[model samples]
Target: MAAAMTRMLQLLLITTLIHVARGKVRVQITNMIGYKDDMNITCQSSDDDLGQHVLSYGQSMEWKFKPNFSKTTLFHCNARWCDVMRRIDFGAYEYMKDHYGCGSDCRWMFTIDGVYAYDSKTDSWDFRFSWYS
Candidate 1:
């Protein structure tokens, strides 16, 4: 029957798509400002709003999601501390670049000097950028 054949095809397509779904990625941001300073962070993608969070020294906030199938997923963030004088507005995650270096777990740390990214291979934090403004 044609109807039965179409249903079979639909089930096959659904199964194939499920097997190819992208893996989830975890992103974490930490505050290492020291001296008991608290950092306020806000992060979002074009499609998502992660809301605002305040992280005290040595505290961290994290989230997990799957990258867009189009490979264009991106999340940007703004951080302010020290009475909002020292601040950083930067790209927190980009699928193309970060996926290779970080695989599934991406970690970033904020400090007085700048940002540090976690290198999973070496189990170390690598300096990424310095404060520009």
Candidate 2:
């Protein structure tokens, strides 16, 4: 009986460790227009409104969401100024590789004209940018 109890405790501990090891996706958004433009930003998933913020030039905000295992979650950001608006979108796996069971912390950044997704395993930033029309 003592041996059986020990086995059960081991199984429980392993299960708990697995659950705690899972990490969520985190994104940081910044307005890098150098004080010339103020941006209104909104981030949302299909079923949830992640957050909204107004960033003056050189300001930033951060948002986080848990991994959705049943299906891919699409998160999108919209940035607006005056009459012009720009948008960017990402799938859960694209933003967080761990969403698909690969083991790495997902950290990403979105700026007014670009993005920088950090690869924890490689310790590198995948950066991209474009002019806002």
RMSD of each: 4.4, 5.2
What lDDT, from 0 to 1, does candidate 2 have? 0.61
Scored by CA lDDT, what does every candidate get?
Answer: 0.89, 0.61
What lDDT score goes with residue 113 in model 1?
93
Instruction: Report the C-alpha displacement of residue 49, candidate 1, in angstroms.
Output: 0.5
The digit string of per-residue lDDT tens for model 1 on 4-84 reads: 999999999888567437578899999997868899999999999999999999999999988886779899999988777
Backbone atom clashes (below 3 Å) for every candidate: 0, 0
Residue 24 miss distance in model 2 (angstroms) = 2.1
Model 2, position 62: C-alpha lDDT score: 74
Tell me the lDDT of model 1 at 130: 75
TM-scores of the models, in the order given: 0.82, 0.58
Over 4 Å off, model 1: 1-22
